[model samples]
Target: MRVVRPVLGAPSWVSLIAGDLDVAQRFYGELLGWDFEHGPERLGPYVSVLADGVPVAGISGVAISAGTGVGWTPFFGVKDAHEAARRGVDRGGTIGVGPVSIDAGRIVIARDPDGASFGLWQGRAAGVGDPPRQTGVPDWIELRTADAFKAALFYGEVLDWDAAERCEVFYEHERVVLRVDGRSVAALRGLDRPASEDAPVETPRWQISFAAPDVDRAAARAVELGGRVVRRPMDTPYGRTTELADVEGGLFSLITPKARPSATAGE
Candidate 1:
């Protein structure tokens, strides 16, 4: 487990909001080499995913009363969840859920002005390390929205993210990388219509991507484990990627990153 200094405005933790705790735990445990540590369910049906005896990520159940969608949620670190929620309100963000106290810390679920949902985690939980970036752990996140510039501006005001002006134009969409503390942590992608083609409009969404050394192998493994392969591994400018969905319809991706440039000249 790696220890990381608190980086405000960067993703400190990522959690899946699942419908069934058992199924979610089982699906991820097998795929990500994680084990579950259940939390007090009275507050929320929360569980921490541990890998090699280190807490890596979390899964929580949305109150049936509220009726929220189930998927992965990224939480940014804050000193005080309540105060952060207030600041978000002052900055035009909406607090969708509580600054409720749990055994470990206080948390608030919020939506940025662009209507992208995220979380604010204010206190440190015991024994939780920085989530791993190695193969099999969740390593990256991207927000697919209608307007990348407005989305960046809205979140920049609330979280102080240094969102880049330049967007990498792809065939179907445009992507802008977001940096915090001088490091790229997340991305904002404009979900535009496919080039010169008509397609159904898609709502904005945040997608979670896990890392793999061999994305093709990972995609095959996912199919063997009762998951659906939405897209086969394909080479892109950035990496090799395969889109997949769990048995219960939770969408995620596997990526083999592109090699970084060497500082030394080519041999």
Candidate 2:
């Protein structure tokens, strides 16, 4: 019998917290050509960004927390935010924040069974689709967890996504692919190195990767703009990636593909 496959879902939107909103705006705007759409300045110090007039993501000023640093939060598109949150709770997850409205969408923040936090967006105006390739904004979301299997199962059941495939890649170790419908939405992988003094144990945080036509150029721009390069750009089997941190210590990465299919191409 021939096996039928489900349609892959598109990634909707992603967000991050800025330690310094003004500096982040200037840096991302200059680097990615992102246009900042200031919401009511009184919206408790949050700013939304638009790409080609579409709401791509938002950033809010975050205070220093116990475990989390100033980092990006990526949201997956769901049909109903409340339902997803409820399912997450049923599956041994906890709600971190809202089933509440922010701008055009209703979002609920929840943690998986293994304590990985994620956002579910029932978008009113912004849908989970592929990000613009030309812009140097978030194009992919990856989860680095201690237990990839449990994380995969928790998200699969909670979000109604399916585990697409499990493949071992030499550069990043083994990766378990998850799909919403048939579309590759996110990846779950185990850490290569244990947390130590230099490599502190970062909490289960989402690493948001910005698309760069040239990883070297993006890394250079990040350094020139007062952002520090945490990991120098290097070619891996998957892609060319370099870790970076803003002047205020928010961490993220710039990635240019070396061999993989274009993430925006629905691969």
Candidate 3:
């Protein structure tokens, strides 16, 4: 439940690919007080989501289509994407996109056995890693799946990460904490199906959490900026947080960390 910094297995980078670039810029800019700066010219409208002039995540402009999945994707830093995809395939996950080249790094869009999507990145540019979540930065990456242990084992063998610890509050549901080199990197938790819920339910997916300075204030700002607040701000032992969907329907959360009570400050 306590997070100090980012380790190798945790989310090193995160990004959102949506239909509208302008909407992404305004919504995230106001919500996180982010400064969206253009990336390389070839990327075309792709921008770095920065806080205090530090790159935290990315916002890419992708053509809108019925099949497009608009959501924040977590990318884990790896030594090599090609090798990671090879090991991922051996562990039962499928490669959805590439071990393809990009301006900053090589990337592989991968899915776990239970259908949760994640990314693997081997960055070539500097400032790609080091430093963890701070204000206006990505705070956490979590997997929500029905088979918590199954997903844990998949990541363990595929990524050499140990999803080993059970969280304090969600112990009944099995919250597996991912650790890399003795440091907690990310976490996975089992999703509950209400008894009255229908079959053919929505599959589990990885979610992105952004560090916020003020929970209620951010939640309100999101609504004013045409975003939908799925869950209003609520206090927790960790911090105050709320779920929100961007104008493009990409889901993410804004959380105020307990470590810094006033305004925001990251890895």
Candidate 4:
């Protein structure tokens, strides 16, 4: 796989905090055909997830018992971790962890105003690379919040995304699209989720979608591997998509990307 470095404020890495590292590894390894390698020691017994021999994500077993829920968090690259964390807080977000030092770089865990958790990293992101969107690597990352416009403002300020030189922001189909150097990287969608007296308020979160060659087969395999299909496979712009919860109930989606035209066509 070709390694491509990410730009400032772009997504750099993703990770899941699982209760049992062994079970998480086994489940994903079998389900997504992924390989694993030991992550930086400073991160403490974590495993970097590799899809087609390229690092795509990480799974850490250290914080599950410390009240951290099992969920996937996307990390964004930052030129300055301290400034990013401060900007997030200034923009109505909250910092849960630090701009602390690690072997690979400095990191900060924070949540947007809507309570969507995300991370900020300042360093030469080692595991960030350009791997073809496949069954294991993330194909898309989205933030589902109550107001996309409001959320966009918060992120734009925190990430300094308004820089005309490298980034572009626009709205489409009632959602805000974030593009880095002409390529759509992520989106923010406003959702109307009504809460009943009995139903608890749901927190906004960044959703990660992994690619699948066959969505239906992948959903079935998830069930066989002790996962639950939250949403049956259905056609969408990203191709047939299915929402799933891992063995530990960490939610993610599977998307079969739409095929592109062959480059040699019309030759």
Top model number, TM-score: 4
Residue range with the least summed lDDT across 10 consecutive positions in model 1? 164-173
* Candidate 1 local lDDT, 111-138, one digit each (tens): 8776778887766422222334576666
Off by over 4 Å in 2: 1-10, 40-43, 52-54, 62-69, 124-132, 162-173, 179-185, 195-198, 258-267
- What are the lDDT scores of the predictions, listed in order? 0.66, 0.64, 0.68, 0.78
Predicted candidate 3 versus true structure: per-residue lDDT over 1-267, tens digit per residue = 112122334467787887888888988887788897888742345888778777777877874743567877888766668887998998889998888877766778888877788988776322222235567777656688988788877776665554312211122224776533233335788774644656455468987778877878888888899999976788854567888999888888878755422221112
lDDT of 4 by residue, 1-93 (tens): 112233576776788888889999999999999899986754556888888777778888866665788889988877789998998998889
Clashes of 3: 3
Models, CA RMSD each: 5.9, 6.2, 5.5, 4.2
Model 2 C-alpha lDDT per residue in residues 1-267, reported as the tens digit of each score: 000111212245566766668888988888777887777532247777876665667777653432345667666656778887898899899997889876556777677877766777775322223334555656556788887777767777665654222211122247776433233445778755744768766566567777688888888888898888877899754568888887777778777744333232223
Q: Relative to the unseen true structure, what is the C-alpha lDDT of residue 177 in candidate 4, on a scale of 0 to 100? A: 81
Poorly placed runs, candidate 4 (over 4 Å): 1-5, 125-131, 192-201, 259-267
Write the candidate numbers in order of decreasing lDDT. Answer: 4, 3, 1, 2
Clash count per candidate: 0, 6, 3, 0
TM-score quality measure for candidate 1? 0.78
